[model samples]
Target chain A: MLQAAFVLVGTIFFAAVVLAVFRIVRGPSILDRMIATDMLVATLICALAAEMVQHEHTRTLPVLLVLAMTAFLATVGVARYVTQQDRPGGPQAEGGAAEGSAEGGAAGDDAAAHDTTSGRAAR
Target chain B: MSAAELLDAGSVLFLFAAALLSLAAGIGIVRFPDPLSRMHAATKPQILGLVCALVALGLQAENGATVAALVPILAFQMLTAPVSAHMVGRAGYRTRHLRRDLLLRDELADAIDKAHADAAHHDVEPDLPGLVTDEDTSTPRP
Candidate 1:
């Protein structure tokens, strides 16, 4: 029963990873990508813990500790950068306008892109 | 079933629950409408899923030391997940990544507008703490 459970859990984790990857690819904005990446890391951590449980060992526990501790730093850095970029007369002021226009267009296109992704997922 | 067998069964159950949470989080990230809404989805696996998996790990641990080691993983995740979520959500809000129409309440916008009006009022003529009237304090400058 335990063996069967492990296989079932593995299959679920695999699906989770695939879905997270899909979100990463389909995410419209940087924040959306960041959210997907965060979820992906959480899935990875859960997978590692499941492995430790299945193997009946502690060898990978440290890896779990390190991953949990540091995963948020990337999110913090990206958020700070986004906030800074939005500020007028900030270091990236010149390029911000161009990027903002492009992002605006992407936002306009978001509904269509969302439909395609959901359609593909459903199919 | 013996004690060891029972523990193993418990661990397996917990692991199954964690896996389901991860699956849910993935679906949420894909289906949520905006960054803030997606954030609500993404945080499930980070906190609840990790807790479930750690509980499973604790149940299956061979020794006390193994269980002890699992503590920090949970602690660190609990500590950091909120901080990151706040930062990301704030950035999303500031960047206009969230759908304003979908929001039920917008206290932040009200506060921001108030602050901007105050700043503009101050920019025109700086307020003196001593000279500031009660009426001026009660109603914000237009």
Candidate 2:
């Protein structure tokens, strides 16, 4: 009876994980998607560990550890990368490029003009 | 089996609770708007969920060695989950893209500024030997 309960609960958890994978794939932003993927990986690890317990398979513990470690490291690495992109003069340092675009040139000029006026006001 | 055969019922209940918590965590991670909020959801729920599940496994484990083996994994997870979340949060702040309205003070933002100011005061060149030999250096190489 206990084993059956575990099996049922584990199966439900696995279904939720599948839905998380879809969110990961369809997230609007890269960070959103990466976070979803990280959650999916974590869910998968827990599910595997639970399966091992349900089956009384001690050998599977090592495999679960390896997978969890890999997923954790990968998630951290990607999060770091995305965070770096958010920095000033980071990969998204396209403020200058936006200025060069004809459609944005007027706004850029206005910003520059505002800066000069502010500087003069400060003086 | 008699009522005496239900000795491991608590383990089954805990396992069920853990599974439900994990599912809630998955929903939280997907639904939270920002990284910081999501990090809160991810770490806290996962830690609780894992603890519950591992405790249930430990209760059902037949031998001392198997239960003992479970201890280290739980300990390591408890220690590392918050550290990983901290790193992700710091990285987000350093990048300056996080939604400031969501944050209260932005302590990390101040820290990054102080670091940059200290580096500037020291006139530390990026090419200086031993300054950035490590692989994780954020400064671009010539």
**Candidate 1 local accuracy as lDDT?**
0.76
Candidate 2 positional error at B23, Å: 1.2
**How well is each residue in A1-123 modelled by candidate 2, as lDDT tens digits?**
676787798786886686577667644335555566666655665676677667766786666556545555666776656633433222344543233332332232133233223322332
lDDT of 1 by residue, B21-91 (tens): 99998888888877789899998889999999999999987689988998999999999999999999877
lDDT of 2 at B30: 70
TM-score of 2: 0.67
Misplaced by over 4 Å in model 1 are: A83-123, B124-142
Cα lDDT, model 2, residue B78: 61
Candidate 2, B63-99: lDDT as tens digits: 8988887776766666656656665665554433344
TM-score of chain A of each: 0.67, 0.59
Error of 2 at A44 (Å): 2.3
For candidate 2, what is the lDDT?
0.58
Residue B95, candidate 2: Cα error in Å is 2.4
Q: What TM-score, over all chains together, does every model reach?
A: 0.78, 0.67
